[model samples]
Target: MRLSLEQIIRYQTEGYLIVENVCSHAELQPVIEEIASEIDKRADRLFAEGKLAELYKDEPFERRYSLLHRQCPEIGRGFDIAGYLGDEIFKLLCNKNLIDLVECLLGSEISCNPIQHLRAKHPARGSADGSSAPDYFQNVPWHQDCAVTSEDSEASEIITFWMPLVDATAETGCMEVMPHVFKLGYLNHQAEGGTMIVPEKLPQVEPVLAECPKGSLVIMNKYTPHRGISNRSDIIRWSIDLRYHKTGANSGRSFQPSFPVRSSSDTGSVLRDPDVWRTLWREAANGAGRKIHRV
Candidate 1:
């Protein structure tokens, strides 16, 4: 929805803002059902191929991903936005409320960045202290969105909308961010352990936990340093982070596809068909591969 004056101020000043109830379960249910159907289809294939032991068809969506993961770590291979692109999924991308919130920060013209993700963080499988948890369950390293992009996109302004499909709690590995640091611009990041801010260069500010319920969104600017914690709870933490910038701006990943989803000045450039969106990625994939992140 259109952000309030105070909400805009908070995002501008703090580098991030936790917007609650920007969407309803009704709006997210379609995407959730699509995902569940995809899981069922994959499970059936694996079962017939003798790669999966049980279909687990009766399990609910929240528990199914982790269940399959425990049996086969590669259960979700290549399961990102491109892999899950469909009519329902495309409609969610053009969600009016989400676009409205985006417009408040990014103005009218907007292009959906290729730096999107569908995160199904598996539950921690170690001691309660979590010191021995696997890398899959570890907290994401502190890094800024801009630092991950190519040098050519260093000047472009991007915003991240981290939307969880279910309620997110601090214990369930909700995202956390360093506030009041977006103005500092890109910082030095190390190549080791994922491209992250250098330990010595990380800001000393207290990280704020972006705990919120389903249908809420955790908004952050391009330079905001944020990371998601491990899922200590039993269920998988399902979240999707979508990025957007002004149309025609450097999308950071020239090899992948970026779509014009909204525009005030050039309405005809905005893409609407789900089939076309899928085709764009298909064509990009068929071409030669290139690095998505600089690191």
Candidate 2:
């Protein structure tokens, strides 16, 4: 599952690469089922508490979240990798096929950064006046991965993987990236909606649409400028973002927990227990406060 030399070259030169069919549907079923089960658990409770209208039990996994959200927005909260740390997701973090590709570019040592997130970008209600959707559910503005991290990690080569649980198409609001922008060095960022790259500081270049399919991932360099557009389609656009950097490097999120996922030199450091992962997240949640991520 290691990437070819040419593919690695493209990733270095272009600052991004699309690797399709990295995992089969059978391999993805575990996470999908786990998420579906979570939805059922939450929906049932919300219904009992009179917060939700109906259970929407008949709806499919991809569509159920949207239905539940339409009734009550709380359904979308606290569902990230850090929120629950499910066994399946922790396993996915150490997925062999994924780590092989990561090892190809990052060598044998790899640490899973704590900036992971599962984005369920629901479709925009309508285009007229723009519906009242949360920032997480709305169109993501143009930005670079490096801008979200602290200045301490400005030199770390943090690799990002945006893997869709379902097919991500242009109509469904796939991510668009400015290729080769990494060569421009770090772009100036400001306190915009979400600490985005300054508009006047942007380079004159067109963006490449990353319409990835299920089981596929779009690999990106830390400085690659990218954004997610509005999901105009009928269904939700589901995707998870995972990051890895050289072991012992400052993981942008100093307050969050990072785990050694692959270590050829020291196998003992690689985290293999889901309980430990959950415990680490719980500890972080209790002690971590609102710290200035960017200077």
Candidate 3:
């Protein structure tokens, strides 16, 4: 709960900053109902042990690895959910008031890029958006999330902590930054590798509707050009990004080595790292927690 120098000069001139609540729905509802009931009981026991196609078929790894849950450990999944929501989602993702509002807006000393969690914009309803029957899948085009993968990192001094577990107004689909546009660092768009949405590329940045509320928190900067528009209503946008790093900067990506089960209750024996122990055994078999109780 820190950050305040005019919110670090509006996160360095609108790279992004829309912090509001912080957290308190009884401290984020029992770890989000215990991680969404452990991801709906592993999607119904991997659809009844069919192995849910090992998550998008045979997985050779790369085809955006079938959207690695929205493309790789960006909190997309793989255990370590901030070590299991320990710290109320890590004080709102290392919230020293957003690390002094990202060290006075990228002046120095940031560090928060192991990539946090929460990002469920679901609602694609019965495929083929064939009008009616709970039509979902709203807007999320206009690409620019460090070019999807890692593209090498240092993507012009990263910064994108768009937190929103509720009240993101503008009809459920909030998130439209372009303000000041990260002083024009990286933006030539044409995504395909991981797929978020690109639509060719033209929006010189204009939308800024983040109306926030439920534990609010938004601060863009991965080249200051955002996206995420859909929810149209009926509600269901839930966000919780949290990606910072200036103190030397380069936390671009690193934290995939899990494998050290040993918590008979003493909760110790930490080792995890074999690709985050096989993505925490595939997010605990698609659940995200529970079962790995090594006590």
Candidate 4:
């Protein structure tokens, strides 16, 4: 599953590349099933606590959360179970096909950054004032991934892989990126709308929509300016964003843990125990209150 020369060239020239069918539905079934189970568990708990009237057991995975939110707006506040890296998620992170493509661009040595996250962008609820409710996670503003980290990792070449668990269409808030903006280097970013590029610094180039189907991968350079669109559809737009860089590179957020997924030079360093990955996340969560390096 290494990228073709044409694909490599396009990535280098355009700052991003869309690799279709990188992983099949069967390959992603584990994570998808795990997520659905988690949602069911949450729904059950909410129902027991009287926050929800019905379990909505018959609803599909994409619509379950949205329907739950409609029943109880507060349901959206605590449904984020992505912080924990379960066995399924760990397996997906080290998927052979995915790492092969990563090795093509980042050499044989690879380290999975701790900045990964699984996003369940629910539909925006319209307010009585004729405006959509504020959706901090779904409607991301334009910003480079590099700008979200500390200056110490500016030299690291981190490649972000955005994979959708469901079809990411224009209506469902697919990613939008400014073409070739990686060549411009890091742009001045502010805290406005999720550490976005300053409006004055935005390039004149038109943004390109990264409409991806389920199991497709959208790879982007760390310096590329991109943002998630506002999900207006009825179903939740489920996706996962993972980051990888060369082994031993400064992971801008050094306070968090990173694990080596593959090492050609020193195979012993490659993480073989899923428990180690789980423990690392647990420790990070326990110490989350400490001072963390912010962009």
Instruction: State the C-alpha lDDT per candidate.
Output: 0.83, 0.86, 0.53, 0.83
Per-residue lDDT of candidate 3, residues 164-233 (tens digit): 7667877666877678856766666653432443455445555677677876678777766666666554
Name the best candidate (by lDDT): 2
Q: After superposition, how far is residue 183 of candidate 3 from its true place, in Å?
A: 15
TM-score against native, each model: 0.94, 0.94, 0.28, 0.92
Instruction: Report the lDDT tens digits of candidate 1 across residue range 1-295.
Output: 6899999998999999999998899989998998888888777877778888977778788887777766675668878777868677788788889999999998999998888877887677662423233584567899998876788998788888989998888877898899998888988888798878999989899999889799899999988998878788767778888999888889887778889989888899999998998989888852246555556
- Which regions of candidate 2 fall more than 4 Å away from where they truly are? 127-136, 285-288
RMSD versus native structure for model 4: 2.7
Candidate 4 Cα outliers beyond 4 Å, as residue runs: 73-82, 125-133, 285-287, 290-295
Clashing pairs in 2: none
Expressed as tens digits, the lDDT of each residue in 1-295 for candidate 4 is 8999999999999999999998999999989898787777777878989999987788888777767766777666544434445788889899988999999899999999877878887777662213243568477888888876778898999999999999998988899998898999988988756688899999989999999999999999998999888787777789998999998899877878889999999999999788988777677653356433244
In model 4, how large is the Cα lDDT of residue 124?
Answer: 72
Q: By TM-score, how accurate is candidate 1?
A: 0.94
